[model samples]
Target chain A: MSGLITLVSLMYLVSAACYVIGLHMMRTPKTARNGNRVSAVGMIIAVIMTFLIVINKHEATMTGSIVLAAGLILGLAYGTIRARTVEMTDMPQLVSLFNAVGGGAAAAIGTFDYLSLTAGSHISFAFSFPVALDLVIGGVTFSGSLIATGKLAGNISGKPISFPGAKLLNAIVVIVIVAAVVLTIGFPVNAWWLVLTLVASLIFGILMTIPIGGADMPVVVSLLNAFTGLAVAMAGFVIDNQALIIAGALVGAAGTILTLQMAAAMNRSVMNIIAGGFGTGDSNSAAADDVPVNVKETSPDDVGVQLAYAQNVMIVPGYGLAAAQAQHEVAELAKLLTDHDINVNYAIHPVAGRMPGHMNVLLAEVNVPYDQMKQLEEANSMFENTDVSLVIGANDVTNPAARRKGTAITGMPILDIDKSKSVVVIKRSMSTGYAGIQNELFSDDQTHMLFADAKKGLQDIIASTKEYLDE
Target chain B: MSQELYTNIAIFVLSILVGFEVISKIPSTLHTPMMSGANAIHGVVVVGTILIALEAHSVLFYVIAFIAVFLASINVSGGYVVTDRMLQMFSKPKKTDDQKQDGGDK
Candidate 1:
């Protein structure tokens, strides 16, 4: 029996090693796919070893084992099918959904363990403490992630939703949760305190997320992801499994760094985002009244001729481009220009799309060379030398308003598309962006607005450019 | 606390340092995939669910364990698969021979 235990421990150690090595390999895109494979391999080993332990123990009833097997098979099928079929445009929703499940599972494990231990006789303070922590963190993650998924999927309004006394209510929820957790730690056998903790935690999660607008989802999702990891680590303590503790802690760290990165990209603190109520939805009414008189509107044919004759062109894409599914169209136009010996590059802002690296994924799907994709710093540096900058369905990221003080997006880092000699913007209307502010770049002397949907606008430009090239 | 608990704490702290060190250096372009990948790793909670199932004698315990198992499996399988799909696109840009040729035609 001891030898078998030793073997299982060694296997877990091996699996943990694989996780570390695999994550290290993810530093470069070239090795990232293999990194995922390596991590999956580690998971397989851990699962198989766990199964062997269960079989040797012979403690599981026949019905219990059958039910477990059924759950495993069904879950595997559902997850595999969804992952295989989900579109890149819907990646944020899928990721949020996954966070929900992972959090739910961790909370469930903690609850069950606590119940069973209490049924057996005396439960220790150490045991109940981790279980309580796990329940709180996991419960919040489960409910918060669900709300985030709903917003992303368009089932719930993406605008920040707040009611009277919402802040006071959030305060009450936090106080209740903290008091319940303390009571649970003191009285390990009483389940009522833990129940209160779980309920309040779930409510707290919903309250925390609903007031955050869609623009901050990347940071919100990353924060919930980190919460899920912390919950899992607490579950590890409850189960006394080193594998869980290690893997969970690693993920917790990764999520923290990502959340910080996302927050920094927008020049907002994580605390401010959590405070919520940033964007007021797509309020075109207020923006229309404030529209500057200097806005220059242009035509697709004129823009096409300008692009065709330009020496260097930079394409700056935002969430609107992804919303209109215009990646392929833009890629085609860029290709036509490249064929004509016109220098073309894509300037990608870090928070340009719904999630981190979202624009990169969308463009990569259309076979845009990764090398042509420029980061914020590199793109900013090249804007001055660029002959014409094509702004596609993007708003706040390129707004010169971000450079000045007192605006909603004030102090935020923006793409330097205005520095180019000539600028062309494609949009549906003079509406504001997610930040709900007028983009000063739209009223610049060199800026020309081509009012159209991103896909249609790009297609028209491509057609006109093709005609010119053919002649 | 017990010796076992002490060792677990040590392992947890060390793993966190390693995670931050390795992940902080990754480029912004891969942040999405990195996030999804980390999401899959925490799916190790499946082990906890399976461990509890072996001890579940009552109907209530069994039900909870079953749900936990199902959710953890999805978190594991779905996360890794989706992350791989995204990374596949990232890796595709390396073999740009066809795209280069298409762009080269005057």
Candidate 2:
């Protein structure tokens, strides 16, 4: 028995190392898939080892085996189908759902642990305390993630919803959760107070996310992800499980860093994120109004002509492009231009897609070569020497409004697409971005608006280019 | 704290440091996959869930554990599969052999 336990522990160590290596391998594109494979193998090993332990225990029950098998099948089917079928534009909601279920499970574990310990009224201070934190954080992550998914999916208004006493109400909810937690600790023998804390924490999660507007959804999602990580770590502490501890701590720290990155990209502090309400989600853009801005309109043929002859062309994509699933069409266009000897490249903003790396993944799905994709910095310099800049379903990132003082996007970095000799923008409507701000680039003399769905726009441009080039 | 608990804490703290180091190295372009990958990695909690659920005594524990076990497994399996699918899209062979001798560093 001892030997088998030791072997299982060693396998877990191996699994942890694999996760670390897998994440590290993500640094480069070539090794990323292999890295993912490594992590999956690690998880499989960990699952097998745990199953072995369950079977070997003297009180081995068929209940555990049946439950494990059932969960694995359902989870595998749901996850595989969702991942395979989901559109690139919907990645945000999918990820939010993933974070939600994961956190909810962790909280359930915490709740179960606490209940089991206290059913006999033998709760230890050390064990009960972390479980308290686990329940609160996990509960918050679960509900908060669900709300974020709702906002992104448009099921709920992405506009910041405020009540008469939202901030005060939130404060009260926090107080209640905290007070319940303290009471449970004070009277460690009773599990009744723990339920109160759990319910309060869950409500608090909903309250916290409700007032956050759409522009901040990315940050909120990332923040909830971090919260889940922390809760999982707390659950590990309650159970004294090393695998859970290591995985949880790693996730907690990583989620936090990602959240900070998302926040910084929007020129907001982490505190502002927690407070949310940065954008109204009320207007098409944050500052969109009746002020009619002058803009040039160009046909796809003209844009196609420019793309064909330009020494260099850079494509700047945004959430709109993903929504249209135009990556393959855009890629086809880029390929056509490349064949005609035009240098084509893609510019990726740090916070471009609904989630991080969102554009990259979508483009990769269309088999866009990684060599052509440039980061914000790399593409910034290229925009200057470029002849044509193709803007697809993107707004704020290219809106010169970000650079000016006193504007909503002040201090928010933007792509220098205006520097190109000629600019063409394809968009579905005149709607302002999530921030509800109008883009100054739309009115520039060098820029021409080809108002259309991004995929259709790209297709028109591609078709025109083929005919124009062949002639 | 007990010796075992102390050791576990040490592991937790060290893993935090290691995680920050590795995650920082990832570029912004890979952030989504990195986020998803980490999401999958944290599914390790299912082991803890399974351990607790099997020994559950009362009906309350049984129902709660059942749900927890299912949710945890979903997180674990779904996270990995999704991440893998996304990563697979990244390593396609380049079509143009013109050899621009460009400066793309991964």
TM-score list, all predictions: 0.96, 0.94
- Can you write out model 1's per-residue Cα lDDT over A1-471, one digit (the tens) per residue? 788889999999998888888888888888989998999899999999999899898989998898789879988889999999998889999999999999999999888887776542556777878988999999999999999999988899998888989989999999999999888777646767768988999999999999988889989999999999999999999999988998999999999999999899899999999998653334444554687778989998999889889999999998889889898898889989998999999999988888888888898888787789999999999999999999998888899988887677878888999999999999999877778778899999999999999999999999888877784
Error of 2 at A373 (Å): 1.0
Q: Give the Cα error of residue A309 in candidate 2, in Å.
A: 2.1
lDDT of 2 at A242: 78
The TM-score that candidate 1 achieves is: 0.96
Error of 2 at B88 (Å): 0.8
Error of 2 at A4 (Å): 2.9
Candidate 2, residues A381-446, lDDT tens digits: the string is 899899999999888888887888867678987888988888899987778776667788989989
Model 2 clash count equals: 9
Residue by residue across B1-106, what tens digits does model 2's lDDT show? Answer: 7787778778989999998999987887788888888998888888888888777766677778778888887788778888887777776545333233443432
lDDT of model 1 at position A310? 91
lDDT of 1: 0.88
lDDT agreement with native, every candidate: 0.88, 0.82
lDDT of 2 at A69: 67
